[model samples]
Structures are given as structure tokens and as C-alpha cells.
Target: MAIDKEKIKQAIRLFLEGIGEDPDREGLKETPDRIARMWEEFDRQREFNFKLFEEFGDYNEMVIVKDIRFYSLCEHHLLPFFGKVHIAYIPDKVVCGLSKLVRTVKAFSLRPQVQERLTQQIADFLQEQLNPKGVAVVIEAEHLCMSMRGVMTPGHITVTSALRGIFLKDLRTREEFLKLIGKQGL
Candidate 1:
């Protein structure tokens, strides 16, 4: 379902008013519309198609796309969590466009998600669609929930990774991937 921008604008107006800000003031007048536009764009994930993974055949080497940047809201605090995602797959009979992999990551990251589950979802989708020999996803993020609230640990980063098939079975292959992403570069 499409998000109603007008409804969000109304809510933003009420939010500003609730915070004792004058919504009609010049600086705040357009804030509601701007916020509505931002959220409308954020909710565009429902429009992506993941069938792009079906375009390649029987190629069995690891494919990796590293450091795709994304931003999302934390479900617990409803604040921003920005991060980078790295994805890899070993194709058995199908492969996807490099941009499609980025888009797939964006589709999920745009929603409120826990880092670990999001990593697994990306790996699982690629594994299911490509039936690859293996799939891997790594995500590193900084959550406002911790940095702006709670214990307020500013420099800490959270890392989550998911591995399937050969990546799960072979330590060397997993190590290679971890090294390539600069976890233990050699």
C-alpha cells in the first residue's frame, strides 16, 4: 500500500505543535511537507522487484559487492541507523545484476530492522533465488539508539554477518571473504 504523504504532513504539523513549535512560522512551515516527502521516499521499498537474480546461469565462483551504504530507522527508538552492507554469493545456475544486489539490500534496509536478521534475510534471498553454492552478507552499523540515548557509546560499531552453504561449511572460504572486506587483510 502506498504511504499517504498528506496524512503524514498533518501528523508532522501536530508533532511540531505538540513540541510547542509554531508550525506556521517560516522556518517550520515547510517542515511538514519536507518530512512527508522524506518518509514517502523511505517507504519506496515495497516497489522493488528481486527477480533480477534470475539472469545468469551455472557460474560457480564467489561474487562480492562490498560497502553498499544504507540508512534505516531503529525499531526500538524510531531513530536513524546508518550503515554499510557487503554481499557475496557463489552462483550455481543464476546470477544477479550488481546493482540489483544493492537494491535488494536497500529494500530491506529501508525498513526498521535488527542488524542480524537483516543480514540473514539478504543471504537467504540470494540463496533461494540463485540456488547458489553459498551466500554471505555482512553489515556494519551505528545505531542512534545507543549513541544518542541509553549508555551513549559514541564510537562503537555493530557488525552482523550471515553465511550459508559452502560459506558455512568451509572456514577458509569464509576467512577469505572476511579478509577481503578488511576484517583481517593479508
Candidate 2:
């Protein structure tokens, strides 16, 4: 859905006032506009252009992209969570551009989301788009909600994974993916 910048601006203003801060203050004057712009950037991910390439030769092997860094807001708390995503796919008849993989991560991460669903959505999107032999996605994130409030435990990383097709059926395939991502286990 399209973001309403004006509504965001209004909401931010009210939020500032609710928190006992003057929205008209010198330092806070442009905060609402800045926040609205951030929402616009996040909403623009739906239009991301994807470039695809058909399979060449007999090159059907596990293609992996690791350490794709991303920042997202936790849906429950609206606090930030930063992470790295590791993706692996065995192509069937199509291959995707390397940068597109990074874009895909951003497309999902630029919204209020949980780490588990984010991992699954990336794997599912790749599976549907490429019709791959298999797709694997692993995400590890540190949630500010846990560190900055509530239980107040810092340095805890939550790891989530989604394995589809061959990766789900083959134990060795999953093991190799974990090893390549420098993890003995998730």
C-alpha cells in the first residue's frame, strides 16, 4: 500500500507531544518530515526491479549469497533489529542476479516484521520466482527490544531459517549450507 506521508507527519507530531516534547522545538522541527521520508523509502521496495537470467550450460548447482546485512523494525515493539541473511538456492532453469538477492532481502526487511516470517518469505519468494530445485534462507538478528527494554538482555541473537524443496528433504544439503555460512547449527 502507498504510504501517507502526511499521516505519518501528523502521527509523529502527536507522538512527540505525547512524550512531553514540543513538536515546534528547534531541533524537533523537521523530525516529522524526516520520519515521513523514511516511511516513503520503505514503501518504495514494492517497485524494486528484478533482473533474471535463464540457465546456461549445465550449471545447476547450489548458488549461495551470505552476509547480506539488513535492518528492520520489530513488529511488536517498533524497535530496530539488524541482521545478516544467508541464502542458498539450487537452480532449475533460471538464475537471479546477485544484487537482486540483496534487494530481495531489503524488500522484506524494510517493514515491520518478525525474523521468522522474514526468513520464510525470502525463501518462498525465491522458490516461486526461480522455481529452484531448492531454496534456503537463514537470518540472524539482534533485537533492540530485548536489549533496550523488557527483559533487557543484550547481545542475544535470534536465528531463523526456512528450507524448501531439496534442502528440506536432504539432510546433507542443509548441513552443507550451514557449514558454508560458518555455522555448525542455527
Candidate 3:
């Protein structure tokens, strides 16, 4: 679905007025337009393609891509949350390009999201596209809504994980994934 940029601009203007900021002020006049443009860029994930997955016949092992940095807006508060995602999958007959994992994370993270759902979406997408024997996704993030407001506890991080197939059933497979990703504490 296409975003209504004009509606967003209007809402931002109203929000500025509600917050007692002069939307017509010299410095703030274009703020709404700028925010709308920023949203356009942030929402580009809506256009992402998953056809990048490629089939491979010989290699079948755990493919680990770790420490992929991402930025997202919290759906609850519209505040920023930034994080690193670790992805691991045991291939069956197909393996995706390494960069495709990063792109998948980017596509999901670009939307307003919670870290937990974002982690699952990446794992689920990989599972569906690559038909991997198993998939594991871990996300560690700091939400501005938490640190900048609510508890006001800075440096607090939230970690979430999603495990599928063998990662959920095999203790050793899961352990190896966690240890390799440096998330053994999970």
C-alpha cells in the first residue's frame, strides 16, 4: 500500500501545533515536509524483493551472519530503536546470498516494529524462501521509548530471539548457534 504523504504532512503539522510549536515558524515551516520525506525513505521496505534467494546443491551447513545493524521506529511510541541482528540457518537444498540476509533484516526493520516481531519476521522469511532445515534469529536493541522516557534508564538493552525447526528441537544445534552468535546468555 502507498503511504499518504500529504496526510502525514498534515498530521505532523497538527502535532507540532498540539505540542505548542509554531508550525509556520521559519525553522519549522518545512519540518512536516522533511518528516514525510524521511518516512518515505524509511518505508522503502514495502518495495523490497525476496527473489534474491538462490539455490545451491553442494554446501549444507549452518550459515551465520552476525551483527547486522538496523534502525527502526517503535510502533507503540514512534520513537527510534536501534539494534544488531544475528541470523543463522542450516540449509537444505538452497542457500541465499549473504547480503540477502542483511536486506531481509533491513526490509522488516524499516517498518514501525517491536524487536521481537522483527526478529521472527527475518527468521520466517528465511525459512520460507530458502526452506532451510532450521533458522535462528536474535535481536538486541535499545528503545528510545524506554531509555528516553518511561524508566529513563539509559543503556538498557532488550534481547529477543526466534528459533524454528531444528533450532527449536535440537539442543546442540541451538547451543552452537547461540555460542557462535555470542548470545549464549540467551
Root-mean-square deviation (CA) per prediction: 2.4, 1.1, 1.4
Report the lDDT tens digits of candidate 1 across residue range 60-174: 7788999999888888877888889988888887777888888888877787788878888888887887778898898999998999899887777899889999989999988
Write down the lDDT that model 2 would get.
0.92
Which of 1 and 2 is the better model by lDDT? Answer: 2
What C-alpha lDDT values do all the predictions have?
Answer: 0.84, 0.92, 0.89
Indicate which candidate wins on TM-score.
2
| Segments of candidate 3 deviating more than 4 angstroms | 52-55
TM-scores vs. true structure, each candidate: 0.88, 0.97, 0.94
Sliding window of 10 residues with minimal summed lDDT for model 2? 50-59
lDDT digits (tens) for residues 117-180 of candidate 2 = 9999999999988888899999999999999998899999999999999999999999998999
Model 3 weakest 10-residue run by lDDT = 46-55
Quote the positional error of residue 55 for candidate 1 in Å: 7.5
RMSD of 1: 2.4
List pairs with backbone clashes in candidate 1: 58-93
Question: Sorted by lDDT, highest first, which candidate order results?
Answer: 2, 3, 1
The model with the greater TM-score, 2 or 3, is 2
